[model samples]
Target: MDRFARIDTLINNARIFISRPSNRDTEGDVTAVLGVNIAGHITQLAAAHDRGGR
Candidate 1:
C-alpha cells in the first residue's frame, strides 16, 4: 500500500492440504484446514476489496 499506493489485483494462491484417514483426523486438524482453506481466502478477499482491488 505504501509503495504501490493502491491495489489493482489480488491473487490468492496460498493453501494447505492435509491427507489423513478420517479415523486419524482430529477436531483440531479439521479446524486448522478449514481456517486456512476457507477463512484464509475470505480474509484475503475482504482485504483486497477494502483496498479497492479485484
Candidate 2:
C-alpha cells in the first residue's frame, strides 16, 4: 500500500486439491482443502475489498 499507494486489482488463483483418492482421504484432509480453497479465498477477497482492490 505504501509503495503502490492503492490497490487496483486482485487476482485470486489459490487452490487446494486432495492428492489421494476420495476413499483414501481422511476427514481432516477434506476439511483442510475446504478451509483453504473456499474460506481462505473469501478471507483474501474481503481483505482486498477492505483495501479498495477491485
Candidate 3:
C-alpha cells in the first residue's frame, strides 16, 4: 500500500529518531517509539502540506 511505502520512505529517508535499543525492547524501546512518533508527525505534515495546508 501507499501507506506502507510512505513508512519505508520515512524510515529510509533522512530522519532523526530518538529510538534506542533497551532491555524491554531487547534493543531500544524508547528510541523506537520516539522515532515512530516523529515519523507520524512528519507524515501528517507532509499530507497537510500536500493538501495546500488544509
Candidate 4:
C-alpha cells in the first residue's frame, strides 16, 4: 500500500484441496488445506486491516 500510495481492493483466490480420499495424507494434507484456507486468509486480512483497507 505504501509503495502504491493506495489500496483499493484485495482479492485472494489461492486454495488447496484433495478430491480423492485415497490421495490425502494425514498430516501434510490437513496442514496444507488449513494453512491455505484458514491461516492464509487470516494473515492477509490482518495485513489489509493494518493498512486501513476496506
Candidate 5:
C-alpha cells in the first residue's frame, strides 16, 4: 500500500521470506505469511507515527 511505501525505506524479500511454509500458514503455505508480512509493514507505520509523521 502507499502507506507502507511512504513509511518504509523499502519492502525486502528477507522479511517476506522468513517464516517457513509450515509456520507460515495453516495450510502450510502463506496464510500466516500475509499476516507476518502485514505485521512487519505495520511496524514501520507505527514507528513513523511515534516519530511524528505528518
Candidate 6:
C-alpha cells in the first residue's frame, strides 16, 4: 500500500464444481478443485498486493 499507494481493479476467476460426494474424494479431484477454486485465487490476490495491485 505504501509503495503504489492505491488500487484500481482486481479480478479472481477461480472456480470449482463437485456434483457428487464420490467425485470430491477421488484421486486428483480434491487437489484440482481446491487448487483452482481457492488456492489460485489466494495466490493471485497476494500477487496483486506485492505487485502494486491493478
Give lDDT tens digits, candidate 6, residues 1-54: 568765555567768887887734887888788788877666666676767664
Candidate whose lDDT is highest: 2
TM-score of each: 0.47, 0.46, 0.40, 0.47, 0.41, 0.46
Off by over 4 Å in 2: 1-13, 40-54
lDDT, residue 48, model 4: 72
**lDDT, candidates in the order shown:** 0.73, 0.74, 0.54, 0.72, 0.57, 0.71
Q: Decide which is better by lDDT, 2 or 4.
A: 2
lDDT, residue 46, model 2: 58
lDDT of 6 at 52: 68
Residue-by-residue lDDT tens digits, candidate 1, 4-53? 76556666676867787777988988888787788667667658667678
User: What is candidate 4's local distance difference test score?
Assistant: 0.72
Candidate 2 positional error at 28, Å: 0.6
lDDT of 5 by residue, 1-54 (tens): 455544445454434564445543555346555767766776666566757782
- What tens digits encode model 4's per-residue C-alpha lDDT throughout 1-54? 457765465566788878878455788888888888886676576577667774
The per-residue C-alpha lDDT of model 3 at residue 35 equals 70
TM-score of candidate 6 relative to the true fold = 0.46
TM-score of 2: 0.46
Question: Per-residue lDDT tens digits of candidate 2, residues 1-54?
Answer: 568765566666767887777999888998888877887666576576676784
